[model samples]
Target: MGFELPDRSVLPRHPVIVGDEPRQSGSGAMFCHLYPANGQPTGEVAGAGAADVDAAVAAARAAQPAWRAMNGDARRDLLLRYAAVLKQHAQELAALETLGNGSPVMMAGYAPMVAAQRFEYYAGWADKLRGQTLSAWNNPAHNYVDYEPYGVVGAVIPWNGPVFAAAMLLAPVLAAGNCVVIKAPELAPYSVMRMGELFLEAGFPPGVVNMLAGGPEVGAAIVGHADVDKVAFIGSGGTARKVLQSAAENLTPCCLELGGKSAVIVFEDADLAQAGQMGLSGAISVSGQGCVNGTRVLVQRSIYDQYLAVMQQIAGHIPVGDPLDPGTVMGPVISEASVQRILGIVGKAREEGARVLTGGQRLDGEYADGFYLPLTIIADVDPASSLSRHEVFGPVLAVTPFDSEEEAIALANGTDYGLGAYIHTRDLRRAHSVANQMQAGMIHVNASGEGMQPFAPFGGMKQSGFGRLGGEQGLLEFLQTRNVWMNLKAPQ
Candidate 1:
């Protein structure tokens, strides 16, 4: 059965939220958000420009001192209230997400609840931000370190998972006593724009949590704003480099959560069924739009054929249709451009000698108007090809075979990305050894499920960008350290 889309009246009109109120963009520029399901205009939002960004940053700057001055307990209480507000409106937010982004409604529905959980988790850490005491060498003196917020933070989130990303960034930033100016992706701004309203409803001070919806110029202004103090970005690596360049203008430190082409290694003795299921799920979740998805699957030569069979069988059955349908397991890519880009990448991989096992074409019939592509499996992928090196950011799995364990390790770490890695094996010793050798921020041994958690640090090394966005470490990203030294002996 098909699911119905929500009425357009539910969409937000004013996409810029600042100083506790939803306001129209200062530039009066506007853009229409397209539903990925059928490429139809979902709704229109005022596109924020430099003037809006300046106003938002000014608001954040003005609000930071009082926000920082408030005791941790008070901040925690407000954050808890905000989390409850998110939970209360989760259904509305989920519907907006499905309309704006193309994630299955059933799946999009979970993002707000998870976001609330993240807020609750970070709320517990509000009062626990502590410093360290140190001894002065051979002197009658005391020394200690204190952690303090950077004051105002500028955050830019991607479209793939807007609500969750906003929560992931805001929870820790606020918990660390920093006010934030966030630039929500223009492609999917409805849910996050609503989140800004919830902050006011939850009793947060005006301008403490400003939200803007716009394109690259808006992000650049935020990163380059001297008063922003610090920046946290989640997006593609190409965009991250641009953000870095802009941030360098003000010498602002940034926490970049960028893209990845993560690897999953399956050994001979691993449970083939589980490995196939988990590996495919990792590659295809969020319709393969995730930054840390395990899209590269490296298998031992012994079980390589068997693994391919399992993966193909699984891919063939994954339901692909309208995201609003509760029965649909997969939805369209974010836009027609995305569908074309993914197809171009797959076509190039074929030219580079990778064999398409199944689903290398855009879906026709009822799905033709939509940005839809079935789960694609490309076997015999060359490690040196662009398909192996660059991120496709779509539901395309590139499978390669290796001989020795060393070869598997080398293949897994072959790409510039080091965000996440997975190893499936029965041998405990082998799992540990392989996991230790994998050059990624997070490693999963013999298991793969939902991607990131609020309790653990999640980031990447090398070209995948740096800094973290989860757990206590994530809170520290928004804070700076101050050292104090006091003389114990008074001069006579």
Candidate 2:
């Protein structure tokens, strides 16, 4: 059901989640969300401070036991109700994201839709949680094992995807009966802060979920809080390292979904059109701000030129304009500094001999003040070049060609990152062969759309990050295994 905003055509503006309500931030600094479409300040929100972080963690600690004591059926129903709330307010949430993060409204809308679906899927598993019943070896022993929730989870969100992040980060934890203290994405904190109100509206007990809007200092506080049991972080590699170090001081288990310099491998037998589409999606979608954007693409020598041509056409047609416009296919990157940083990366790649197949500069004339970057495809990039080695985190695609299956595999696995990779080919044997050797945690085999579902395992290998965040595996991450043993009075 669609719900109308009582405030009428607006968001909470500068909302921040504190316990079960949307409250003004007491961090003393006002955060204004600027519209990247035109470089205009659209809204503001309260930022969290160290004190706020302490308050949130304390609230979550106090509420965890009661929340866990409630039967699974009750938790399931509450989550389902939350899903309804998400669905009802999807439009407003989408708008808030666009105004703050520069994501197109349509793309922003999909996040919440995905969130609601995931909530329902995880809700179904709440009452279905199973423990293993062990067999005895004629020794009069009765043994079994059960799962229990970690008392308080501290989750740090990334700015690129807010609504969807909440789904993957919170659904499984909540499904397992744990309370959470979220460090809301400081870059785009408004919409998530608004989510604070839905907790009570969805009938969840107060303190079950709390959010704070602050920078790295607040995040450090969450990780160091003695009450926090685990930390879930999704951001850059550098930040993940810091989070890991801090969480280690307290021996808190941490789930890191860090940066990626992933590659898209398009084989000779792959459909050129489909490969081009995936190429566009990997580097162009969300303005390539996603952690798993396969900016480095390795196409087989036989199809390399054709695939490049298709990619050029795709690049030319990608709409760049106001994020609020329904026709816009691409929006500006997060900020003006981001625009300059991406431009610098492109300039360095050109200096290192990579040819700019299409756009390589920021849109100047009409889009002068905004953080606008035209779609750019850098062809003939060296595998060892900085463009190919590091995460650009912008709308830049670097292409290289490989001659054989072995070379393709080498190219795909060469990077330090192992978050995600894409493979486009028709032969099942080749697909399986290459996939077996690919080092990434998640591989899209001739498919697309982030490779995520409520029940699918999603994470990375190597420096990209660790720990799973979906399905039974995700549910398990939030739980600890406990063994129960008893001696039978008489042998059965």
Candidate 3:
């Protein structure tokens, strides 16, 4: 049986758009979207190439002025209207996401809710953008700092959470007064095109929000364009390097949100029930597909055995079934290729000294057609092993035992990545102290994966990628600061 989309009536047509009008790829090619759950054809979109990207950039470059000239209040009003439409059509978007990536329907639905929330959040900031006046700092001169849009922005969004990521990037970028040409990645472009249509329905001006489809060529076109001042890319580490190189050719700035191999530290003093709940939540969230998922588990030796048992039981019980089934907590990975990659990593861990406490294979029989994997935990793991140091991006957790707080911190912060980390403990003072020592862009204290507010900035340090994606920093990413200075007295 074929996987069914919850609602097909709201589906958008194929072909990339340039200034509100749709056009096929230069050679009239199309990219067919397949349901990752069952490998069925769900929809098709225009396979945009360099030609389409160039046209989109040109359109956005042309429309930037008028869009910037519009009052921020007017922009905010329009964005608010779009936010309403997003909430109204959330279910449709959710179904589309599940179809694209095999994300569980329950989790897929949240993408819309989060997207709506982010849009609403950024919309509120539209009119609140401010520049600084520093006349007092500059003697005999009046100095003012103005934040201006970077004109056309090339945003290449990832496939994991297309709607949410796109909305997160788009909302603040638009609020900052930059017109955008969004290049939907290989996995999901249909939902983005649909959102573009929604933006049009909300009365956004043509060319202000453009959509492009295809592969790396399209992305290169957008990022390498002479007129496109900056690019925001979300993807793999290798892919990020390529994007950076492209941006370098144009001397265009970039915001890169890449991969992570985060850690979750559970102290002996932590509430076991609460810690288990939160720990498992991080491990199996989106089947561990999330970038900020706490994949490394460091437990205090005092309660290591007991906590390991709890985790094993938790892993054994998590549901892995159909994405459409509400009872299924975890769904398949995005594609069979992804399933193989995850399994390959697990196999390598097994070949090494790491012992599998539970689950090291794919689910078959009833779930044969889809890419389903049970939660896997590798205990007796070396903190420096590939399994512990690298990102599995699957429902695999690497648990390491630590003797003291110093060892725990060392093991937790061993990896090169510093995206996000979690600490679970009942001692408020200890929690604060440990959290302060944990090196991550975002930290969760006494819990796992809590406190991701739109008002707070989210990004990473070191190789995990730089630049912020939310809050005031997100808006500023699309803007350039200009200093205007005037002499108090006329020059002789």
Candidate 4:
């Protein structure tokens, strides 16, 4: 069967959403979207420009006071209702995600509910953010700290997982009583644009949430806006530098979530079957475009060959085809450029003496037009090679062998990016020791498929970018602290 796409009628026509209404871009610029499944024209939407970004920011600024002034219980109730609305339209949003981004329908289906869960999780936190009452050293004085919202937040999300990224930032931002302007990725803006509409339907104030669908210029404008109190960005580190440069002009605080070259370490005593399956899945899930994917695999030398055999068998059997097909386990990357880039990295790895155990080439025949690459495993990868050091952001796994537990830990911490690390081991003490030594923000032991939990902190370390995006830390990202002191002995 051929690839199937979602109905265009379900997509929003006007991508610039302000004050609870979807409207045309002020600049009248339009951008077309292509279906990654077949590289066919999906449709076009008006692209936001500097003017539209300014309008959205202005709207958010105007709405922030009222949003913040509302009682926390009221804000919590609205967020809870919004979560329900997201669940109600989960399938519709999932179809839009698969249509534009080429994630398999089965996997894409989880994003909406994941978003809903985030909202629900943060909803409980809405009324629960508390401040500290400090003991004063001076005579008869009361000292306390207050958490205040940043007033306005500008968020820039990438194309790979728009809905999830939107929820990741938006849930905590909104619950903390901040108004926001979200710059949806031009490559895949459908689901996020619809998300803006859902916010209004959930009875949020008119200007509380605004979304702009555009390219880099719009993102730049949002980051540089002096009125924007805070900025949250999720994308490549290169782009993050540009964002930082622009944000510096206004001295706006920023929270960035960038790319990773996460590592998966497997000890000899590990359940090789489980390690191979989950380790490969961690590297290739989301078509290997995830920022936190464990694409670099470090195995103990004794079981290195045995692990490669298991990985090769599993990778070869993984289904890679039309994203809409329920049976398809892997789908196309974001675009043709992504396919070329991933293939180029694989080609360079081979030149550096990395052996392609399975699936190093792009698929042909039925998937010729689409940007498809099967799950690739390259064994004998040199730890010092570019393949092991840089982020491929594709479904390609680079495996290197380590002689000891300490060697495995060194290899896992060898990269500049420290977003996530995975270790598969039978020994609990080793798991704890290695996990403590891993430089990444999040670590998984004997498991890789649990995914992001809403209750814990999610972020990276070092070059992977700073700032937490889940749990209480995420909520605090949009808030500022204020210290207050009052004299209790005034009457004396």
Candidate 4 Cα deviation (angstroms), residue 434 = 0.8
Return the clash pairs for model 1, or none: none
Q: Which parts of model 4 have CA positions greater than 4 angstroms off? A: 24-28, 449-451, 490-492
Point out the higher-scoring one by lDDT: 1 or 3. Answer: 1
Better of 2 and 4 by lDDT: 4
Distance from true location, Cα of 162 in model 4, Å? 0.9
Model 4 Cα shift for residue 415 (angstroms): 1.2
Write one digit per residue (lDDT tens) for candidate 2, span 1-492. 111112424656334555665675556366776667777766566678877878888888889999999888999999999999999998988887877688887788887789998889899989988999898776777899999999899998888888788778889989999999887677777678667667777878889998777677888888888789999998888988888888888999998888898889999999889889887887678999998877889999988889999999878888887777777878889998898899999999999999999888888777777788888899999999999999998989999999999999998889899988889999999999899999998899877655787879989999999999888899999999999888886745
Where model 1 places Cα greater than 4 Å from the true spot, the runs are: 1-4
Model 2 misplaced regions, further than 4 Å: 1-9, 489-492
lDDT of 1 by residue, 1-492 (tens): 343557877776667887876886546468888888888887677788888888888898899999999999999999899999999999999988888789998799999999999999999999888999998987789899999899989999999999999999999999999999998888888888888878888999998999888888888889999888998999999999998998999899999999888899999999999999998975568889998888999999999999999999988888888898888889989999999999999999988889999899999888888888989999999999998888998999999999999999998888899999999999999999998898899888876745578999999988889999998899999999999999898788
Candidate 2: which pairs clash? 14-44, 14-45, 48-213
- Write the candidate numbers in order of decreasing lDDT: 4, 1, 2, 3
Q: Each candidate: what lDDT?
A: 0.89, 0.84, 0.83, 0.89
Clashes of each: 0, 3, 0, 0
- Give the winner by TM-score: 3 or 4: 4
TM-scores for the candidates: 0.98, 0.95, 0.96, 0.98
**Model 3, 375-466: lDDT tens per residue?**
88888788878988888888888888888888888888888898998998888888888889877899998666656777889888777899
The number of clashing residue pairs in model 2 is 3
RMSD for all candidates, in order, please: 1.2, 3.2, 1.8, 1.1
Candidate 4: tens digits of C-alpha lDDT, residues 17-93: 88777785546477889999898988877798888888888899889989999999999999999999999999999
